[model samples]
Target: MITEESIQQFSKNCENIFTQIRRDVIGQQEVVEGTVIAMIAGGNVLLEGVPGVGKTRLVRTLGRVFDMPFSRIQFTPDLMPADVTGTNIIVKGEDGNSQFQFQPGPIFSNIVLADEINRATPKTQSALLEAMQEHTVTVMGVSRKMKEPFFVLATQNPIEQDGTYPLPEAQMDRFMFNLIVPNPGLDELMAIVNMTQKTMAEVAEPVCSGEELLKMRETANQVPVAEEVMRYAMTLCSATHPNSDCASEAAKKYVRLGASPRAGQALISAAKVKALMNGRFNVAYSDVNALAAPVLRHRMKLNFEAIADRVAPDAIVKMIVEEVGTRFGLNPKKEEAAAKAESKKGLFSGKKA
Candidate 1:
């Protein structure tokens, strides 16, 4: 069970993490928060952005903020699966006889930074599927469990299509959140330049350990969800599928493929953490709405019509959210109140006439 004291500690730990991350990251607060939430929820994150937008730097800062072994794999076309998930090598034994020994690769770390992950081939990218989902790497029929608090924070270039391969749907579904890192504003740009001029090195310090992070995840799992709110989350995820019974108009029109079952699991798990972060003891409808985009954007496959009309996934998600909210009467409290007030005004005007 979650106690008040434990909740306070969780919030404090989150605050310390953000404080430390700010020391190295300049802007993109949403991306930072989403990444942290996914980390605490024990899920992988995929960051999409153009070059030089602090995507790699943010991952490095997270490594510093968490007292864990960090490894950076600069993904390229020439990269091979063996380079990522180790292979057995022949080595001399004590008696000078050659024997097969397993050599672990960079994947055997607490936090892995797969920078420019899309640059690698599909075959090489598939190497991470098992590790990301099962948290284990299989080599030569042998499986090795990942260390505690393991996370894969991958970065990719969105605009650069040349020499880059699109992440397969199976691999994409493994991610909990696909955060889009946008360009910094003028003030943020100045701050980043000034900070870098002082030192390019990451100055963030570790505030949480692997054990403590796991504890936080455990605590988040205990945050209660009301039945209505739970059903609403399910409805939102179900509505993403155009063929489903609860399909929204936006989904039927624009989406070619909906999110996988993992998306619903990720939605609730992350919402629990989000509630705890805001000092709430229970999950709310607002939490689900706030997280819908990052959780579903990469998971859904937009049709050619959507692309031809220049309708981005985010826009489709927004329309689906509104439609579903209306269908389920799950709009935010403020919106509900405004709607009631408008109805009352029309009623009074009709009575006066």
Candidate 2:
């Protein structure tokens, strides 16, 4: 049992890890925090960012902080499945007999930085989908268990689409969150320059071992979520469908495919972890609200109208949140009306920086 005292210890350990990571990463605090959340929750993440945003550096710093065997796989179109999951090699034994031994690939590492994951062919990308979801690899018709506390942080170059294989809907749904790493602000950039100019302390150190991390995740799962909160999460996901009476105005017009019931499961699972992270014994409505964007972003699909209208997934999530309202006791129509009014006020107006 993870007691309150251990929870405090986990928080302290995470702070130390963040302290080490911040030394090297001057900006992108949100990205680093999201990565930590996913890792602690035992969920995989897809980081979408433009080039030169230090996505790789974040993963490297994370690997160092967790004190795990980190591996980087530069995904390419020609990459094969065997390359990601190692093949059985014929090793010569000392007894002069040759036998097949499974040599693990990068996917076997505790932390895998799938750099430019979209650049890999679908076949190679499919290889990872199983590992990300099941935390195991099936090679040569044999299933091999992965190391405990395994996590995959995959980065995608949104600007570079050509020659890149797009992840299908099934594969995309495997990710718990799609975090967008934006460019740093002016002050953050200045801090980066100054930090680089000085003889600063190194920004990569392990604060906790793999065993401790697995324990923390187990504890996170144990956090209590009320039946009402679970119902709220379900309503939020279900209301995104256009045909459903619960559909939000934006979802009806812009969304093609609504989120699956797995999203409902993910919402509650993640919300439980989030509550524990926030030092709460029980999950709250605010916890569910805060997680709506990340939970629903990648799971929902945008149609041609949305693509032409430039409606983003975040925008759709926001509409759903407003439609569902912070308090689910009221009728759904009121919130749907509120969502329309917000959009009319140009809710999705600002440029996504």
> What C-alpha lDDT, on a 0 to 100 scale, does residue 23 get in candidate 2?
64
Scored by lDDT, model 1 comes in at 0.88
234-255 in candidate 1: lDDT tens per residue? 8888888989998999889888
Model 2 lDDT per residue over 1-353, tens place:
65888778666666676677776787665567667777888878889988977888888888888888899999988889999999999999999999999988989999999999999888889999789888889998999999988989999988888999888988888887788999889998888778778854555778778998887788777787788877888889988888887788888899999998778877787777656655577787766766778779999888999999998899889878876774466444554464334323320122111
> Highest lDDT: which candidate?
1
RMSD (CA, Å), candidate 1 to true, equals 7.6
CA lDDT of 74 in candidate 2? 93
Residue 102's lDDT within candidate 1 is: 98
The CA lDDT of each predicted structure is 0.88, 0.79
Give the per-residue Cα lDDT of candidate 1 at 58: 93
Winning model by TM-score:
1
